[model samples]
Target: MGDVGPYPWLRAVLAAFAEEVRGLGPVLDVGCGPGEVTAHLAGLGVDVSGVDLSPKMVEHARRLHPRLRFAVASATDLDLEPGSLGGILGWWSLFNLPREVLPEVLASFACALVPGGHALIGTHVGAGDVPRTEAYGGVPVTWTTHLWQPGELGELIVAAGLELTAQLQLPASGQLRPQVLISARRAPEIAPGR
Candidate 1:
């Protein structure tokens, strides 16, 4: 959060994926907490915007990246027109939702994309949702962090009309939690050729 930036490997991987959809259209940074990654993509020459459910978070993002766009919105019910976005970044955010809510959110993500639009989703790896009452840095906090098997989340993404392009299960390292990073793409149209 707060533009602290992602782990080196994670940052490199995301940047590479972002480059794949560079000229397609704007990328929606769903749950873009403090615009860190959103700013990263923008620096990479990709058209990007940030969206988070919390107004405070959006405010922080706006302050941090005033020239970029940041909106307060829910991933479960996006305001975007169908087939409008080129890519989506759901980094370390989807796991905060209940498992039952994922499909709807994933569907919404798919609907907000143009044909061939791409999405990169990241989440923790485990079996159940864990609730946390205290913050690590002494700040008060209340939230449940859900975990999932990579295959399970991939299945949900595929069911939501996007084709799963790749899935990476990274082992825990240093202070970072083990994570699952998934990349998917909306099916593109075939040209009249052969």
Candidate 2:
């Protein structure tokens, strides 16, 4: 993704954050619009693969990031086998998911992650379900369902078997709203004590 104002800075910050972190292995860049982030990770010597909902985006990403693997796939029903990923990076993707389908998609992410794997997702924070019909790059775009509360998002991820670790509240700017940067990890196992 190209820098839309401060988005470039945010991207840089996210890159630095990932690099300094340890323990994560191969990563799944979900909703990899143009594979820029995937390519960035590959440049850092991280094993990275990407998946996007748009075929055009997939083709563009493949062209831009020839060293990384990318596919046109839905987040709700990824074709990956169980325990296949070490981490997942979902950039502003959860907002695009319909409320009813969120749980199913979260499960897909969880199933693909290996034990102890983590996922970082960027999403809008609202007080109630927000119905926003907006335009992206001059294209008419409409997001079906968006969560308004942090608790709702927490419940969604926890239900998918991921434990919440952190949440970053991005600043709201212009017509664009801020989002919650959520990071969560998959538990290794259910403790016998529990």
Candidate 3:
């Protein structure tokens, strides 16, 4: 996935998210495939790094974006420190996570984020799971693509203690399914004796 670049709408969403958390703290790109989006955020002046479950992917990302940081890690096992990240991105990356596990991951995101930090998630829009035996030029793989409706995903995000701030729904085109981009923000901290 060498700099395949993002869709126009995705670029806009990323730009906006980067602007929101530019100086708060570093951002983490969960499931960062090739670090393209990680590099994109860095170009926008947001401090960002990426992690992927596949060591091969992380290797490619590191080789491609040498200036950026990439690590081998799974979304399910991210041991993030509370109030550390300014933002977290799950851009088109969390579909493989089981439905039950996603909420826990979102909760982790909420806990890791600083007050006022944001989380941006992009996922295929639908209702069930699509099993796959191959992907990306027919590379042999075993995984399930779990599709979710906007409202269902939004409910999980809100339940994770983040406020839903924006949602963008895009229609299916070519081989791509309909997709939704949702952005949520952790509530800001309150002052003492306000």
Candidate 4:
């Protein structure tokens, strides 16, 4: 996935997201492994930075895209300023989080975004967790892949106070499970005496 750029559909989604958030505030790419997507948004002229749980991945991202900001941080422990971000991206990143932890994370995304800010998330589509012992190129790893049905994830997003704006579902192909991309936005704040 790192060798190839984002798929056509994903590129389109990301382009629209970048356009929506331009000049609103900085965008954070959570779980930004290797920083490819972060760089893509930057190329599209977005004010974007990236964070990942792995220090090694952060190092790689820094080396690969020196102009962009990359940090070692967990999605569960992000120190986001309230209403500071214009957008957030969880592209194929949050599925490893425990089911119970996801809602809290989503709520934080809601709290961290300025009114009218948007979050775009993509995840594998399925039911329960699939524990993995190896990853790409047979690299040994220990993590659980937690999957969600589209409706279930959408409900969680809405429950976190963001309004669902769009959903794209992709069917399973070859070794890959089906996946879903969802976009949600914080409602614009209302003025007093409206």
Candidate 5:
């Protein structure tokens, strides 16, 4: 419920991913809390658009990052047209989505992108949505979903047609416990000439 920085190493890893991935365009930051990562990507010179489920959070993001595009929408149902995005960053969002709904959520992510697009998903090592025992900044909300193993997360993305790229886990905040991270890309169709 507070703004958190991308872990130092995670930042470096993401930067490297950006450098290596060619032709990525205006990005979609899913679960883009207050749009920090979206702002960071925009700073990197990549055009950016973002979507988050929280209107207050989205409003806060819009105020802080008016230069970028954003909307209040579900990751499971992005309003964008097909083949319109270059990438997606689902940082700690799907945890709120039930496991049964995870695949559909990912399928929606896939539908929002063009071939060769990229997505970077972040998750915890073994915890589902923390309950809404309290509110953050006056907004009452509940966390959703469940813990996922490495292979399970990977399988979901692949089933949605996104290619697996890498998985990186970082220690949790204020502690050294591990958190699971998943990075993936959507593959393009094989061309006839090939």
Candidate 6:
């Protein structure tokens, strides 16, 4: 799955925010299917790790980028220490989840990040869930994509204790749906009564 439409833009956005990740600590690429984005972060000298629910994807990622770390893990339930990660990339991954689960997963993203950490989340912009029953490119595949309005996802990010920093909605070209990219930062710690 090469960059279909707004993928290059998405990558550019991540590249722009590299400093936020660098300042905090290591980065985690959740739902990192084949570790392409994770590898990109690693290439930028960001301490990064990739995690996917499928073991096959993990194996493939390891084979593709042997030097980078990859693991089979669910986004909703992460095996990470609190306040540990500096940045997270959920590129083209969050729309696969059901709406009910987004809060939990977003909270997990927040939990994994240190105070002032950053996250970049990408998804298709639309009203509701879209189920794809047929395979693509002669490969047997079935999946559902849950679209969201930018405001909807922004609310979730805020609810997860992250401050909304930027929301970029790129218009659709040809067959592609309009994509929304949200950048959020975990609030910095505060001393009591300061």
lDDT (Cα atoms) of all candidates against the true structure:
0.86, 0.75, 0.93, 0.93, 0.74, 0.84
Q: Which stretches of candidate 4 lie over 4 Å from their true place?
A: 1-6, 192-194
Task: Report residue 140 deviation for candidate 5 (angstroms).
Answer: 5.2
RMSD of 2: 3.3
How well is each residue in 31-127 modelled by candidate 6, as lDDT tens digits? 8887888887777778999889889989999999999999988887786788988988888877888789989889888888898899989888999
Task: Tell me how far candidate 3 lies from the true structure as C-alpha RMSD in angstroms.
Answer: 1.5
Q: In candidate 3, which residue pairs clash?
A: none
The TM-score obtained by model 3 is 0.96
Report how far residue 43 has shifted in candidate 1, in Å.
Answer: 0.2
Q: How far is candidate 4 from the true structure (C-alpha RMSD, Å)?
A: 1.3
Candidate 2, 50-161: lDDT as tens digits: 8999999999998987767998888877777788877888877667687788888888888888887878777777765665566565676666647546677888899998
What TM-score, over all chains together, does every model reach?
Answer: 0.93, 0.82, 0.96, 0.96, 0.85, 0.91
> Could you give candidate 4's per-residue lDDT for residues 34-144 as a string of tens digits?
999999999999999999999999999999999999999999999789999999999999999999999999999999999999999899999999999999879999999
On the 0 to 100 scale, the lDDT of residue 185 in model 2 is 80
Clashes of 4: 0
Poorest 10 consecutive residues by lDDT, candidate 6: 1-10
Point out the higher-scoring one by lDDT: 1 or 6. Answer: 1
By TM-score, is 1 or 6 better?
1
Number of the candidate with higher lDDT, 2 or 5: 2
- All candidates in order of lDDT, best leading: 3, 4, 1, 6, 2, 5
lDDT of 6 at 51: 89
| Runs in model 5 lying further than 4 Å from the true structure | 1-6, 20-22, 127-130, 135-140, 172-177
